[model samples]
Target: MTRIFSALVIGLIFGAGIALSGMANPAKVLNFFDVAGSWDPSLAFVMGGALVVTAIGYTFVLKRKAPVFDRLFHLPTRRDIDRPLLAGSAVFGIGWGITGFCPGGAIPALGLGYSDAWVFVGSMVAGIALARLARHTMAARAAGKAV
Candidate 1:
């Protein structure tokens, strides 16, 4: 229950921050990407601040033996980038550049009644489903089974 409550509070704060910072605005994000054109460096500062805070928070949290709500830290063990990672990252970057709405930004934008956000979020969900299906198919083929 404590974990759940903490998560709720954290999520609310994050969403509010995203909204307030104009990160939920697709045009702002697109402008940030337009480096050779009328580039907006403001989002870079926001990202840098987030990075600093996250680095400090991680340093403290990781020094502990376990998480506050769990017995052990749930961390990703993979260190090597593979084909799937590269492919997925490229796809994500392309989508983000075109739509100016990554998953994190788009969700909050949805709450603010943006139609583009709705479309982006819906497409993101469909992409996730398609990726999962592809993974299952690949796994089945690797095991010499029909998917």
Candidate 2:
């Protein structure tokens, strides 16, 4: 299908960009966080460039009636900063600071055969699974049912 193919192509391009930008390397990303030691500012420039591109792209893309693959644009509807959002943000920041692998970069880093990538990706999957399970259990409890 066109949708599936488009997604595949887009993902490949994104992965290539992450790799080419050195964002897939844990050491590089970690160094970016390091201020007193071997600090790197290239990643910051890369992020700034990405932000600019995204801003420009959004300006043009949002004007379109709908996405090429979908009848409606699937954007986040929530704007409130709730407890779960804060908790999740903290978790994500801690993980990134410690491992230097955001979800987007980690996936592409897998192709580089890095051990850190494997560990990060594994932990990310486990975390997601645990979150889903916890949500389901909590929902069941709220309904006065055994999970």
Which residue runs does candidate 1 get wrong by more than 4 Å?
Answer: none
Distance from true location, Cα of 122 in model 2, Å: 1.2
The sequence of per-residue lDDT tens digits that candidate 2 reaches over residues 2-100 is: 889989998999999999999999899999999999999999999999999999999999999998878999999999999999999999999998999
- Highest lDDT model number: 2
Point out the worst 10-residue segment of candidate 2 by lDDT: 112-121
Model 1 residue 95 CA deviation in Å:
0.9
Question: Model 1 has how many clashing residue pairs?
Answer: 0
Error of 2 at 141 (Å): 0.9
Alpha-carbon local distance difference test for all models: 0.93, 0.94
TM-scores for all candidates? 0.96, 0.95
* Model 2 TM: 0.95
Among these predictions, the greatest TM-score belongs to: 1
